[model samples]
Target: MTSLSSEMSEPGANPLDTVERLALANDWAFHRQSDDELAAEIAGQWCNYKLWFSWHPELGVMQLSCALDIKVPAKKREKSYTLLALANEKLWVGHFDIWSEEAVPVFRHALLFRDGNNASIELMEDLIDIAVTECERFYPAFQFVFWGGKEPHEAIVAAMLETEGEA
Candidate 1:
């Protein structure tokens, strides 16, 4: 059955609503946290992460934030910082960083529309896709740094290496 996914992709559609519909169609769990925000927990290949999206219609800007919840050991904080810096350099759309107060690393990206116009659903979907895909791709590097005692450069190289497998 053809879903309303195409219709929802039209410009001027509410990005948040589009996300909600897509999430349901994909059987993913999500919650509408507010008129302008939605939270989704995605179970990924390596691990799970909670993604929170905030959209400001007036400004036509959206921010997607995901908390990896992998705390950097106090002793390894410098390595964590180094890893993040290296990882971010390879990223074109989004970047990863540690939340200093909590020692939790977060992946964040922002989208801005020209002249305060609403974003098309396709753009919204693309934003979410990048967030999840990048997180899944590089999560293990964080693990290696925090747990496996791997050096930052080595961990990033391991993360950036493409593996052939079924998705």
Candidate 2:
């Protein structure tokens, strides 16, 4: 993990790409809590086992919560995925919706940001990590479209400039 100032000096580095375009994001942090800890934390509130493990330095926090729904099939539901942003602020509420299918856990390769279409390869690893966590919770597999650093996905990630999302 290079110093923030180091990246700041680079002319080509995009502000939004800092966390999402990282090649070696060694500074990011992750944690795994036990069921006892969970029970103690959310004793009264409704409990959902969609656990979260995350790392967000520029966003000032890298917290993940299994405190939400996994959006299982039988009917499609939207899952709000929290993504950190560093556009002059530490925290930004970004989202990606996982719509349920006939399968219990089917993750469609859908990028949910209008301005986040370019240079997102760094997010791949992060997304993979999150998806892996989701898989663990749901006892299912990811309906992976571009798992091995491949196209449309890779093209969007590799581009030096931003592309259209939904405009």
Candidate 3:
């Protein structure tokens, strides 16, 4: 990866192209928004999500964000906050959040590369996997708070419960 940054420093090195190639190799559908930005839609266990990634070659950082389909009702904003706080606690790499302007839930994570380091396909794929898995794992919890009319604690507990003897 060290050689990669050096090559990028040359006249024409498009970081977004590296991202596009990886997305194609993985057979994931994606669109290039600009020279520095790319977006993709992925299907998760509970719902589909839109992922946006921006590459800052100067800073050697990649910012990845995923927007879940669930939206918190205006009336349930407080409950949503409590649930997000609980969910964010267990997540080590990324955290769940509510976008105040839209009242939508989002999961975000960032990858920082040291000087001379470049982004790898594996790293990008893993980041997306983590975000999707976390969102699916907690989808039911949010549903409980918003539609089931359950308190935050009750919602999480019920969502985490495992039932046996299924029909």
Question: Cα RMSDs of all predictions?
Answer: 3.0, 17.2, 4.9
Backbone clashes, each candidate: 0, 3, 0
Off by over 4 Å in 2: 1-104, 112-117, 140-167
Candidates ranked by TM-score: 1, 3, 2
Q: Comparing 1 and 2 by lDDT, which wins? A: 1
Question: What lDDT tens digits, residue by residue, belong to model 2 across residues 1-167?
Answer: 23223323133333234433232343333323432111111111222233233433233233333233333323222211111011102212222234333223222222333222332444544554454343333221111212222223322234224457977
Better of 2 and 3 by TM-score: 3
Q: List TM-scores for all candidates, in order.
A: 0.84, 0.22, 0.83
lDDT score at residue 27, model 1, on the 0-100 scale: 73
Per-residue lDDT tens digits of candidate 1, residues 36-153?
A: 9999887888777888889887777778898785778999988888998998998998899787788888899977754435554566667777888888878889999999989999
Give me the candidate number with maximum lDDT. Answer: 1
Error (Å) of candidate 1 at residue 15 is 2.1
**Candidate closer to the true structure by lDDT (higher is better), 2 or 3:** 3
RMSD of 3: 4.9
lDDT of each: 0.79, 0.30, 0.78
- For 25-109, candidate 3 gives per-residue lDDT tens digits of 6667799988889998887778888888887867767788888888899999999999999888878888998888777788998
Model 3 — TM-score against the truth? 0.83
